[model samples]
Target: MSLPFSPQSSLHQRLRVGLGTMLVPLIMLAGGALISFEGAVGSFEQQDSISRQALFPLAEVEGEILELTSVATHAQPTNTMTLQNYRRKQLVIKSQLALLSDYFQGQPTKFNSVQEIRRQWLEIARLCEQIFEATEPEQLANAKVQLSQRLQGILKNTQELNYRLIAFQNEANFDKARAVREKVRYLVAFISLLALALALLFAFYLSRSITDPLQTLAKGVEKLGQGELHHRITLETQDEFNHLAETFNLMANQLEQSQQDLYRLATLDGLTEVYNRREFNRWLLVEIERSQRGEHPVSLIMVDIDHFKRLNDTYGHQAGDLALCEVAQLLQREVRPGDIVCRYGGEEFGVILPKATSADSWVIAERIRLAIAEKSVVLPSQQHIDMTASLGVATYPDHADCKERLVKQADQALYTAKYQGRNRVHSAEVNECNHQINKLQRMLVKQGT
Candidate 1:
């Protein structure tokens, strides 16, 4: 059985209290009804026993009458013992009649016929007294006829009344027992109905409470996932459910802030707030794949600040950082959309241009070199510092095969540019390793001559 109250001041408490309340009252009522039914049964048994005791004497007297009558008619000759038995049986019949009168004393009308039968039985008793006094034939015959008739009627009435009274008491007790049983059944049904109703009510309340908050929290979590950090679910109650909702809201807000922080971390270079080396590699690979798939020409331009370490040594590390930022911004301004500019390393940067051939890439690299050359930055000493960059250009499937190799070969060309001159645009085709081999061969021939 379930009760309709909450167990504690919590969200799911109704179920606990509902069952407890229903069980307590139902157990008490069931026990009380059982005891009441048992008491009723005891009373019914006691009444039955009293009725049986009252009827037993009548049954015994009727048996004696039958026996005496049989003896008087069947025996060929009457003996003194028979005479004494007849007289004693007549006396017992009168006594049973008196007892029946007393048993039916309250209902005078019900016993009127039996009372007349009792009066006739009294006459029969007087006749038996006469029989005991005389030993004559004519008197015995008349007395016998009168006594048999009266006694027969009286015995029949007494037995009939006893049977009727026993039957009536039995039926009354049975009806009472049945009624009590039905009452018990009804009480049990009522209790069960009450318990069922309470259980449903408690379930409804608990489910409503739990689901409402859960729905709110679910929506809140979803919105927070979609970047709505300011959303919070309301707590309508002062309970653990409310606390959980509050915590969820807090966690959602924290997660949104964390997501923002991660976004910033992902997009910005850790030191320079420009594109990082990973971004440069990603752009180069994307451009290479796009060019190969679409049959478009892609180009990579590698740039390095001139004497960056010497500049860092001349000024402080902070000035070197400012110089890098200024150079990165200048390079970004010089590039177009679909052109990638990233800080390749500490004092190096890279650009990947999609659909650009070697000549176009070389021209863009030269422009970037000239742009950086034109720009000047104020050092920590409040003096203007002028710097230049060396650039190298390489095209897909022309100077290198893969994006990484292309970028590396361009970086080698940039090294060549730095070696050949301090600041300039150099092409992989110009250095082309084979060109140097031919130049060295020409030099060896000249030395041999």
Candidate 2:
């Protein structure tokens, strides 16, 4: 059976509370008397309500004291948790003593027992300090032996008080306990009502306060998992939750930066900062697929720096690298956002133009060729070097549907431009593109051998 007093609700069990103060050692148990209260209320017999109420909690307090002594004596001296629990249980036992003390008012003889118990508790607490504060094995061993004896004496006195409480030492103590219970019953009833309301309000506020940030953090984690690298957690509580949110955001930032570094290393040219050959090939296939779906034309322009070997031979490799970077940046400026400019290979670049016609691509190729011929790259020694490029433009479905065939057609046209003269643009003529491609392949095979 539960307590009839309104203050007796499990509001405590439902809404967790923590209390902190400096007394002793060990850990999370803050309110154990409340747990014992239910038992105290249930263990009461109507025939002798005073004896049961006072004696039950008293016996529990005695037991807890013994347990604390055992724990203090045997527990590791370095264990921080032992001290925290010892402190918390000490408070709990203190509360129990307070409740029992209330029952002995006006009865001097019975009340002295309560006073002696309090005195013994002070001695026990002193022992507790000595036990926890002891650093060496010898000091700790002496403290433990003394604490065990002190607790045994405390327990013996507590038992005597229990026997006297059961015997009903005075009619005044009984009559007062009964009168006090009535007043307390009404007082607890009112306070319990107030406490219930407060607990509900606190529960609502605490739930929102704690759960809202946790929900935000949980959602942020989910977004990060789905590759939303820019996602961050926003916890505004000036507490540990805020610190946790900061840690999570920091982790996300580092991960996003790491991913970007990896992406650049994988797909961008080291020297030119343009899309590299690998990315170019990948985007070429992607653009072709998009064009196939839309039934729109896609174009490829293959550009090669004219007499690049001669430039390196004359100016040095550093100048050649500078020229490549300058040309790549110029190509990027000349093209639309939709177009992709890539460093195709040594002294070569490829441009993918989606949804563009052969005529459009031809104009772009001419513009690129003109830009390369006009731009002068400054060398490290303050020397200027003018570079020129030969460009070959080929349209998809006009040149060939496959990426390989399209590349071959553009490459062959570029060869044809170089064959006629170096700094000019040539479009792949469909009439002889296959013949030119076969001839180029045969030449490449011969060069390989």
Which digits, one per residue and each the tens of the lDDT, describe model 2 over residues 330-355?
99999878999999999999999999
Q: Among these predicted structures, which one has the highest lDDT?
A: 2
The collision pairs in model 1 are: 2-18, 2-19, 3-18, 3-19, 4-18, 7-13
Q: What TM-score does prediction 1 earn?
A: 0.51
Q: Against the unseen true structure, what C-alpha lDDT does each candidate score?
A: 0.76, 0.80
Q: Give the TM-score of candidate 2.
A: 0.57
